[model samples]
Structures are given as structure tokens and as C-alpha cells.
Target: MAAKAALPPHSPGIATGAGWARLRPRGGGAMRGYRYEALDGARALAAQVVLVSHGLGMAFFPVHSPGAAAAEWFGRLAVMVFFSLSGFVIATSLSRLVASDGSRFGVPYAVHRIARIWPPLVLAILVTFAVGWLGQNGLPLLTKTGDAYRLDAVAFLRGITLTFAPGDATFVIDRALWSLRQEVYLYAIAALAALAFAGRGARRVLAGGAVVGLVILTADRFFYLQSLALFAAGAAAAHFGGRERLRALARAPWLGPATLCLLGAPLLFVVRPGFIDAMSDGAGFLAYQAALGIPVALCLLGLAIGDGPAARAAARWSWAAAFSYTLYVIHVPVMTLVFSLRAHLDLAPGLAGTVATLLLALLGAEAVSCAAALVVERPALFRRILFRLLAATGLARPAVQAAPSI
Candidate 1:
């Protein structure tokens, strides 16, 4: 979810004061000494899982089955992985900037975060808009035009800026954007925490107040409140992951394996979403989020430090992770396009056709995600573009590529 890169050179830490304006990500997401290939793999796995789960949901659309609920659960499980992994990776990245005895968001931090996250995200939003507009106007390729396909300008602004009130029922341009919204809140809290911890003063007081304000505001939403715990747990997990005592604790590299589906079906059976209205996916649907975050965080910590079969498999899938962020962000539109054509597909007459449609949807989404990644996500072009723009504005110089650090 954090999608940060243009990666820092293995330097002392992020620059501050005047130097902050010049910070730029140069090398790919690499750090000197060690590489978290496992983390990359986990990202790939989570993104793919979400894509497949959504595909499954579309396959069984207009029908309700244990499998359908199970599919939704799997997607939620993958979401937990994304949020947890995001926390871990973000904290790890924050380590460099914050390690210098507490830090505030210097210009470098803003530049890094904006450059890393906004480009691909904006592209995805635009693409979603285009796709949604066509569908809303009866393009025949977007059947399920929930909030995502609605071409409403106010919603677009709210979605892009993440201005929706905590737990507001308003959906974003893409359903996938919900996590991004949550991620924004997470980033704000983390930033304020760092600011609060910086050299003691009234500044800390202001930050502390902001934190309290954030907490009180988010408390209105189930996910908004519980996510703080998950995020903190993930941050703590990152800090402890490097400890010798925790080194061997991460043996299970895989987070939501196929075996977990057995549990999801049973769990969703007990969890219904009607009180807050099924359309909004209220408290009952979100109840498992924090609970799932704990295990997901642990499993990801294991993956980050393990060498088991699952870890090895994850390492091999590194290429897919390159586009994981792009895939996750843009998937709603790709899925909409694919599923729209599902009813039009002439693969077969019965169950086989349904199955084929599902598979095709998944494949189509992946294929499009890959293409979009090449254009936007790959090589961290977004960062480079921002860097260039900054340099043009005299806010930065060409970055000196360095060995990737977290």
C-alpha cells in the first residue's frame, strides 16, 4: 500500500532542513547488505490473491454460496496481508529517517511519499474513470457499476484526496481505493507519532493533540479504530524482526494459504453484514480485519526472515511484486472490464463456461495489470518523473543511485 521507492541510498538517513528538498529515490527498491526478496514475494502473493478472490466473487455474482462468501473472505484476508505488510515495510523505511533520534516529515519525506504513491495511483484513478464512464454509458463491459463506475466529480475529489470522513459509506473510484484511504490515515498517524517523539518541546504537544484528535475521529469507524492496533503491531513486528530472539520465529512464510479457505467459509458463516446494510460492509464484515491482521503480520515477519519452501517460492516470484501496487490499485477497472464480457463469452454452455469466465477474468486482470505496471509501476518511473519535475523546479538535483535500502 505504501509503494515508496526511488529508494534511498544507503546513507546515514533522510536529509533535513534545506537538504530535504533534494532527496530523491534513485536505485530500485534495494538496500545495501540485505534484500527483502521475501517481502516482495509476499506482496505479489497478496495482490494475486485479491485479484483471484475478486474474480471468484464475480464468477458467482447474482448467486450466493458458501464458496462466494469464502471468496470474499479470502479477499479480505489478502487485504489484511496488504495492510500488515504495508506497516512492516513502511516502518522499515521510516527506520532510516526516524532513527536519527526522532524526526519530523522533512521535505524529503514528503517528496518520497508523494513521488512513490501518487503517480501510479493517479494513473489508476484516471483509467478507472475512463473505464467506469464507458460502462455507465452502456459500454456493455461494466455490469456491476457500484460506486466505482459512477462518474461523480465530488466522489472523485474525495477519493483522490482521501477526504471521506472515517468510516463514511462513500465508496471511492475503485473499491480497491478503500485500502488506500485507510493507508493515508495510517501514514498520518505514523508521521505524527514520529513528530511527537522528536526532540521534546511544545511541538510534541501539538503532535500529541493531533494524534488524539485522529484517534477520536477514527473511533467512529470499526476499521478506522482497529487498524491503529494492526498498524502498530506491524510496526513493532518490524522493529523486533531483526532481533536474534525473533530470527527463528518466522518459519511460516506463507500467510493465507489454500488451507485457510476452510476457516474463511466457516468464519463468514458466523459473520453477516446486514445491520449496517450489506452494501456498506459494516462492523460484521470488518470484525475479522484486526484479528486477521495479527496472524498476517506474524506470517509476513516470518516470510521476511525465513528460508523455507514458501519463502523460496516467494523469492522466485519477485518479478510479479514489481507491479503488485499497480495491480492492487487498478484491479477494479480491469475486473469490471473482464466481468462485463463474462456474459458475452461463448466458452461453453454450462458450469464450464462459468469456470472459464472466472479464469479469463483473473487472467485478463493480471494481463492488464502487468501492462499498466510496465507503463507506470515498473522501474519506479513515477519516482523518476517526480524527481525530474523537482529538478526542473530547482527543488532537487539528479539523484545519485545507491544500493537500495528498505
Candidate 2:
């Protein structure tokens, strides 16, 4: 993993009542203070929370589950956080690349992004296929046609390429694939922006324009474009909220808790019956999602700014952060398999059953995800292979430097 640059010292350190120290950065530095170390663990925790919420929603329908409403709302919020954080991280990294050599969309950057996303994604797809094949007779959770699991070669290929269309039912293997597509699209846009704007001033102008473009394009189209606004929000944060600004925000005693309360506010409405309907009809779902991005962006900013013991405590989950992508990609299939087993055994339905199912699914998914990360997601193993392939095909320069491990 790449070592993040340290924050510049500007404001004096302030001690919070809870023994946490707040350090703010000063302006006029070399612009090397933007780092992601504080946000890694928080991102991991958010991803895990998303997995848990998905498991709960899958195991117990919202209509039947007591906490399904909260879980559903949490799942959406977590994804938004993921997008915002991704934007921040990508923007920071791209700025570093540009600073290093003034090459924004180089072969190295492209290769690194591919290596980062494709391996775990491909492996997860294969695992999903295997689960679908083996559990065809029993896996009731997956969409099926006739007597076998529904597997379309075209849709699978589209998914592999991250080009699957929105509202496509072909993603039965893993509904989470949709977000991955959006992520890839955002990467492409970022790469273009980086390439088009070499100077710092030009990049700032591009970022501002991109934010406005995202909002305008996202109107009434909540599926993917709407999500881009969160990415733009993150980019804005990276552009304007330097280490000093972020650290100052982090110093606030109530910021973290306040962000949590803001995130939780939607639960009150989500818990109500027909809340989904209300959102779709009355609130204009896509518009509401765009609105929701505001608080989610704030949460991401809070997480990035936070430091001291609280940040360190979160960073302790670095292992989870390392395997978060694998977990996100494969959890659905693993959970589906667990649900199949539960059905095969005819577990009685109630609180106990639901708890057992949820626990089993979570444990199974974590175990599988960890194994996949160890075997295939490790950059040391897969990146070398990818580099060799790229080199042989002349897609990458022979002397291209290895990208910093994420």
C-alpha cells in the first residue's frame, strides 16, 4: 500500500474533552497534504454495514422484518457514502499522478484501475455462476426460467465489461453489480477530466463544471447519473477542502455524532408502510436521492477529516478495508447460497430463525470473501499477471511503474 502524505501543520493542536487531538493543516504548502489514511477504515466499516443490510433485506422481507426499514435506508446511505468516498480517493490519487509526472490518464493509471476492479469482480462472477449451477435445484432466491438457473451469455458478458444496462433483470447473480458499473463509469469520467486539465487551475475549473453537469444530467435519472453527483461532491471536497479545512472540521466535538444523526434521520420515514411508494410517487425518488447526496457527502467529509484516537480506532479495521471490494462483490451469492440451505432444511420462520439465517449468511459471506482476497485479490499475485498480459499485448509500456497498492 502507498503511504499517504502527512497533513501540513497550520493550526495548533486542540485536545477534545475525550482525549482526542485535532490537527489542522495550513495553506501555502506544496499541496501534498491530501491523504486518505483517515478514511480507509471508515470506508471499510461502511461497506460492511452495507453487506449486513443487504443480508438482512434478503433474509427477511421488509414487510416481515422488524428493522427492515432501517436496514433499507442504511443500505442506500452506505452506497452513497461509498460513491462519495470513492470520488475523494480517486481525485486525490489522480492529483498525485498528475503531480508526479503531469501524465493524468497514463497506461499505468489505466492498468492500475483495471487491476484494482476486474480481478475480484471476475472471480465473484465465477463464484456466482458456480453457486447458481450447484444450487440450481434448491436456490430459490435467484431468478430462474423453466427448471434451471437463468444465465444469459450476453448479459454475463455485459456485466464482465461493466456495460450492463439499468433495469436489467439479468443481474440475478448479484444485484450489487449495478453499483460497480457506475463506479467504472465514474473512473472513466475522472480519467478524462484529469487528461483534459493538466494545470491546477484548469483542473479546478473542470471539477466545478463537472459538478454542474452531473446535477443537470442526473435530473429524473436516478439510476447512474444521479449517483455521479455524489462523486462530484467528493471531487469538490478534494478540490476545496484541503488538509487544514478537513482537520478543522474533524476538530469539532459534535461533528461525528451529528453526521450519524443526520444519516439516521431517514429511518423514521423508511420504517413507515408504503414509504417506498411515497418516495417513488410523492418525493420523486431520483430527486430525493439527489437531495440525500448532500448529507451523505457531509458524512464522507466528516470521515475524511476525522483523526486522533477515534480515527485510529476505525483504522484498526484495515483488514476489513483490504477485503471490502471482495466482500461487496461476492456477499450476495454467498448469502443466497445460505438462504438456499436454510430453505432445504425448512427452518422455522420467526425471530430466532431470522437471526440464525442472518448470522449464517454473514459468516459464510465473510469467509468466502476473505478466501477470495487471499487467493486472487492480492495485488502481488494478480497485478503481475495483468501487467504481463498488458505488456505482451503492447497495451502497456514495458517500463511502466507498478501502481501503488490500494
Backbone clashes for every candidate come to: 7, 1
Clashing residue pairs in candidate 1, if any? 6-25, 6-26, 30-404, 30-405, 31-404, 31-405, 250-302
Q: Which candidate has the highest TM-score of all?
A: 2
lDDT tens digits, residue span 1-406, model 2 = 1111112212112212211111112343312343345566667777788788888777766442447666767777777777877776676666555544454336666766776788887887787777766665544653222233345576567667866544232266577776777777677777766654553566547665774575466555435665677777776665556556554654566766776676676666765676655443454655666555555555555545555576677667755766788888888878877877777678857889978888988998888888888865665565577778888887766655554433
TM for every model, in the order presented, reads 0.78, 0.79
The residue pairs in collision within model 2 are: 25-244
In candidate 2, stretches whose alpha carbon ends up further than 4 angstroms from where it belongs are 1-31, 63-66, 142-149, 165-170, 199-220, 243-246, 277-288, 291-305, 348-350, 402-406
Provide the lDDT at 398 for model 1: 48
What's the CA RMSD for each of the models?
6.3, 7.2
Q: Write the per-residue lDDT of candidate 1 for residues 1-406, one digit (tens) a residue.
A: 4332322322233434332213322332222222467777777887888888777777774434556656666676676666677777776666566544234434345555665566677777677767766665665663333433345677566556766432221243366777777877887787776666553577778888999999998887646766676677676666556555444455543344633553354454524533223313556545555665566666666666567776788878777887788888877777777666555554455788778767776777778778877777644454556557767887754441121333
Worst 10 residues of 2 by lDDT: 15-24
Off by over 4 Å in 1: 1-34, 61-64, 99-105, 140-155, 164-173, 251-288, 344-349, 378-380, 384-406
